[model samples]
Target: MTALDSFAPAWQIAEAVKSGTVRAEDVTRDALDRIKSLNPKVNAFTDVTAERALTEARRVDAERDAGKKLGPLAGAPIAAKNLFDIAGVTTRAGSKINRDLPAAAEDAELLKRLHAAGAVLLGALNMGEYAYDFTGENAHDGACRNPHDTTRMAGGSSSGSGSAVAAGLAPLTLGSDTNGSIRVPSSFCGVFGLKPTYGRLTRHGTFPFCDSLDHLGPLARSVRDLALSYDVMQGPDPRDHACADRPADPTFETLTDGVAGIKIARLGGFFSTDGMPEAASAVQSVAKALDTTGTVEVEGVEAGRAAAFIITNCESARLHLPNLKTRPDDFDPDTRDRFLAGALLPASWYIRALQVRHWYRENFAKLFQDVDVLLAPATPFPAPLIGQRTIEIRGEEILTRPNIGLFTQPISAIGLPVCTVPVFNSGMPIAVQVISAPWREDLCLRVAAHLESEGIVAAQPPSHL
Candidate 1:
């Protein structure tokens, strides 16, 4: 690997810039060059902010030259999912309809925060249409190919966030997860992704998916990068009412505390079944590494997933009601039908779903009382072929797109923090979810970092990249 390749980790890049070992301009230019060479094959980046990135890099260099104190992510080149509003760029939430909308007045809240921490914005990455997909196939923008195997799917709606990080296009990228958007892609692309507890980060300026379930977090190659980005983005924002009013809870300080004395358990029952052998083995490997054979079952997990589906449909439909009435033709057919069905959902069903959600949350909170972290497969299996629809899981045929989030939905339903750590196999990479109670992201990161330290879980970028 070249010197530039050594900077693939955001933390390393930041430290290098901070110590005057490398200029931020050089780092930014190297990243942009990589994007130019590799993006066509991976389709990870939808936009490349070359000019803005150079400008920011030069500013960072100037600060360093003047001997000013730098931020934690100083000089890191990062990107955001296209859903985020970038100033002077039209926010296309993977749809053709939003292409004509006026450019954003300013950067999104998270982008502003990252910028304040001295992270340079590279550009916007591609995602599923309106953040409504599990596969990274965009009808308007085109499919985001997996870096591991270009013919395979990169799980979405945060498709490009995973692809970019895996391809080494950017060390850190922000993705919004309403269901498994963040985790699924991380699994498929062989990278680490954080889907922080809902409301942990402000959602102000991003395109809405499911307001109740929407969460914005980071995708990176290392546990420390995830913690660094997450710490930089945490804060209260009046713009997003859902954002927690709590002060920043930094995880970097405690990331290497180790998992000793922490009770970790594997999620059994529904999670153990209806998945390929690879998925089961991934979780088992993580469980074995943690030396925890104890199992905990979250009752009504299937029902919880069903409830999440109902809520996602209803909320997403509500957000697009006006557009659904005016330009339904502009949406991806799969997204359109789902939204239509959601719009037609009975009020009774929606209300009951909400009630069930609360009940599930209560039960999940109880589960955390005994266990500090829970382990589960991030996806039912590795990435399916790009265009293939059905997947055979233990002799049962299941539709590929919807079922990919089967394991993730139930956990995200109650808004718990989850860190998806990539687990490599002989074939493709799968991921295991390290879940913790709400607001206890520290615990999740701690466990994930421990696993990384042991070399049991690590990010393996594609050789072709």
Candidate 2:
């Protein structure tokens, strides 16, 4: 059997498998081989389900042989961040303490959906401990290195999801974004990532981080793959109370709907890319490509970001309070310290933060009334060197971990849909955030697809890898 190119996008592989040009089992073996060889360099995966992957691939082949139609993601190999449950594999959530727990009884709802679409599960990918950090450094699982530059960070807490797709170990990967986990890594690792409106996708069977702000989405090398994976996973799940009970508004078919009628604008104020040269250039490139000259601002972002921080810290801290009391030493020191701070915050502060969140969301709604889509830098800067704690932005040194989400947090706080498109203006890839109103994921993805069509942005294959 001829092996498929490891770097092929998920859509192409699916087409080849469905057309009988290649066997799904052969593609699965090739994918497993790539993971075995490349995962060590990037530290992207925590587990590799070879037996299960082969079994799934075989099923796909059997269905094809029986003349049964396969789903859109047929024969594609993919992985999920470790925070999502995988049957017989412990959902480590990048924490040593979680290792004490038994393996999950079944896969996460999203994972099951992907499987039903004929995407094979390669395994669980690495991530920041308990999905708390933004730097992608995990004391327990080691750092998920950037595929573009092994010495640099991959961004987190969906570090492995980004790295795996960039390295071509998997064509598609699932990642959860609470603050900026999905967008940050997508920017640093040079891939297309979607953070659907909060509650757009079901989060059942996945470990919780910040319940109010957490979102699950897909990271892929191509916009169509992102759309296809996202389309299949859309629905209502009663198990995840946060999931919206609306009918699925699929974006795959509408991707070619250009930005002609959309009211696109560049973001100013807090979304400005003043300090970071790479980010500034990336945003400028995307704006110019879209012919967008209008600059708009969503007020109250500073307060919104602050509120998101407080909510994330408090909710996550509450979830792990029992573990912190019993096995504090098992927690990552960085994550533990943040959780400790959250534990000490007054209940009144949490209440106030909630109030601020409600106010900020309304502000976003009002801003979106004038614009169909907005553009901003995905990360303040590109990937930092691994273990680098502080970054100098505009002559002032700031903590790298927290500031990475400077632009992403405010949008996440409101649960608006966003699609991050990679722009290669520097050695390390930066990205532009194509944001739309809540439940308007189609608008954001359509804009991203337009950028891709114009060749203004792309997921460039990592040459260093």
Q: Considering every candidate listed, which one attains the maximal lDDT?
A: 2
How close is every model to the real structure, measured as TM-score?
0.98, 0.99
Q: Per-residue lDDT of 1-465 in model 2, one digit per residue for the tens? A: 435688888999999999999999999999888888888999999999999999999999999999999999899999999999999999999999999889999999999999999999999999999999898999999999999999999999999999999998999999999999999999999999999998899999999998999999999999999999999999999888888485799999999988889999999998888878999999999999989999998779999999998998899899999989999999998899999999989999999999999999998898778899999999999999999989999879999988999999998998989999999988999988999988899999999999999999999889977
lDDT of 1 by residue, 134-168 (tens): 99999998999999899999999999999999888
Q: How high is the CA lDDT of each candidate model?
A: 0.92, 0.93
Give residue 454's error in model 2 in angstroms.
1.3
Q: Which stretches of candidate 1 lie over 4 Å from their true place?
A: 273-275
